[model samples]
Every structure is written in structure tokens, then in C-alpha cells.
Target: MVKVQQSKFVASAKKLTQCPPEDIAEIAFLGRSNVGKSTFINLLSNHFKLAKSSSTPGKTQLINFFESIWIFKEEQYKMRFVDLPGFGYAKVAKTLKEEWKKDLWEFLNCRSTIKLFIHLVDSRHTQLEIDLQVSQMLEKLCRGDQSVLKIYTKCDKLNSNQRALLSKQGLLLSTNQNLIKSQHGGVETIRLEILKKVFGYEG
Candidate 1:
């Protein structure tokens, strides 16, 4: 089993160049405002308070990096998880939004240590225009490397029928083959899946 041993805040960067040097593999989370990105990070890390969760949208304004140590089969591995500012519906100044967009683009394109990019979508809604736009961008950027994963969040809000339907659409995480809904095994499933994909962890 893969267990998170230590997780702590690393650095907050407003621009790509200001980000810490590429020393360890990083996995980034991108999504719209109030999409539970922060909550997801905290849950997956098994550290409920590691990432601040707010009911208000646009609370995370910077590129927050968390350095975590995971032990898999008695071996230690260090990884970074980046929480980028939300894309749509943030009640922030237009200029701030533009700056965030610029920084995000640079981080996605220039970060060599980024091993996977998790694009989160709300399970209660269908794919939106912003999601498509981001998908196209990832297509151009990631090319055919399979470096992108679309994760449907808040699956507990959906009924069994809805979850089954979503699964048919291939909206579920491939590693767990289920909906990552609420505070359950969902977080652990995602954590292990990411480790398996990025670090070749058997669990």
C-alpha cells in the first residue's frame, strides 16, 4: 500500500519562473472555482488541513505547491502537488484573472517535472465550454502522451444510476474504475491511482 507519510506547504508562486526549481515530480490539479480542488488535495494527502478549503470561490489565488512523502512497499518517494487558481466564475478582478491564466499556461507548458495533470469536473453537471477549452489546450500541450486525466468530483451527490451512467461515459478514474465521491475511499483510491500511474506503485 502507498501511504502519505508527510505533507506540508512548499511555496506559493504567482508566476511560473518564480516557482521552485524542478527537483521532484509534480502532479497538478486544475478546475473551475468551487470545484472542490482544495478538498480533494487535502483528502488525498490524508491530511485534512494541509490545503485550506473555503466555501467561497476564488479563495486560492496563487500556485500553491505541497511537498509530500509517500511510502510504497517500504520505499520512499517524494512528490509535489500543485493547486492552481480556479479558471471560471471567480469573483476576482479581470487583471488578476489574466495574470493567473498567464501563469497557469506557463506552468503547464514549461514545468518539466509535471508528470500528470488532473482536470477536475463536477459530476453533477455535464462537460462545459471551459472544460472543452481546457481539453483542447491539454491536447495541444500534452500531445499524445496520456498525461491528462479527467476526474469527476462530487460523485456522492449522484445516485447509483447516475454514477453508472457516468462510468459508461468514461468519466470515472481509470485506476479505481469508480466515482471519487465525497469523503470515503474515494480519496485513497485517487491517491493510489496517481502513485501507480506516476511512480509505478503496484498498490
Candidate 2:
């Protein structure tokens, strides 16, 4: 299991211009509104309140940062989990959506601190246009380096069979397809693989 030593809320940003300095390596979470991005972060950290989670859609309207310190082999390191606002919220204006999109793009493309992008998708939804588009953009930005990992969230909501099927489908949709099908299987397996791939090994 990955261990989170220290987890705390850092700041929120409405634009890339307000992003924190690119000192610590960062990993971002992306998904459509109500996809459980915050919940997943909370689960991983073993802190239910580490990131704000809400039942209502589009509750996260800005970039939220959670700083974590991990210790392994008596060595300490810092990392950040960035909760990015979800797209495809119809209630928001087009210009506002565009602005958020621009902020996301700038953060992904220009931030040297960003090492990986965790693209979350609801397990109940098999196909998503916005998710696909984000994946494509990340693919282009990373240039085939496998910098993005698709995370199928809300696994607890699915039965065994449904989970298995969704896991298969998620792997098929990922940029580095083979990683999702390795010795360990399914979403939980994929999550560990991602931690290893991005952080050089799970803490």
C-alpha cells in the first residue's frame, strides 16, 4: 500500500497565473463533474477530509492543492495532488469553461512540476467524450511518454463482474495499454502500477 505521511490543503487557484511555484513534483486528477476525483484522493491518503468531496456536481470550481510528504527508507520527499475542476458542466458559461480549459492546458503543458496526470472516469459510464478529449490532449503533450493514467473511480459501486468489465474497458482506453494488463489486474492494480510508474515505486 502507498503511504501518505503528511497531507494538507495548500491553496486554490482560478487561473494558471496563480499556480504555485514548480518546485515540488505534482500529480493532477482530472474528470468530469461528479466523477469522484476528490473521493479518490481522500481514499488514497486515508484521510476522508484531505480534499473536499461533495455530492453535488461541479462542487470543485477551482484548482485545489493537497501537499503530501512521503517517507521511504528513512528518506523524505514531497508531492502534491492537484484537484482540477471538472469540465462539461452545462450550467457554467462558455467563456468561463474556456477559461478553465485554458488554465488546465497551461498547467499541464507549462508546469515542470507536473509529473503525471491521473484522469479519473466514472466506472458506470463506458464512454465519455470529454474524458477522451483530455486523454488525447495529454497524449500530445507527453509525446508518448505515458504521462497520463486513466483511473476508473467508484469501484465500490460496481459488482464483481461489472468491475471486471470496466477494468478491461479502461485498460483498452489507456495510453500505455500494457501496463493496465500486467501481472496484477483491474483498477486497484492499475492504481498501484501508476504509482510505481510515476513515483518510481509506491511509498
Scored by TM-score, the top model is 1
Worst 10 residues of 2 by lDDT: 171-180
Compared with the true structure, what per-residue lDDT tens digits does model 2 show for residues 39-82?
77776555788888655677457889888775556656577888
User: How do all models score by TM-score?
Assistant: 0.86, 0.80
Question: Compared with the true structure, what per-residue lDDT tens digits does model 1 show for residues 49-136?
Answer: 9888656777567899999998877888899999988877778788977877877888888888888889888888767999889888
**TM-score, predicted candidate 1 vs. hidden true structure:** 0.86
**lDDT, model 1, position 111:** 86
Global CA lDDT of candidate 2, please? 0.70
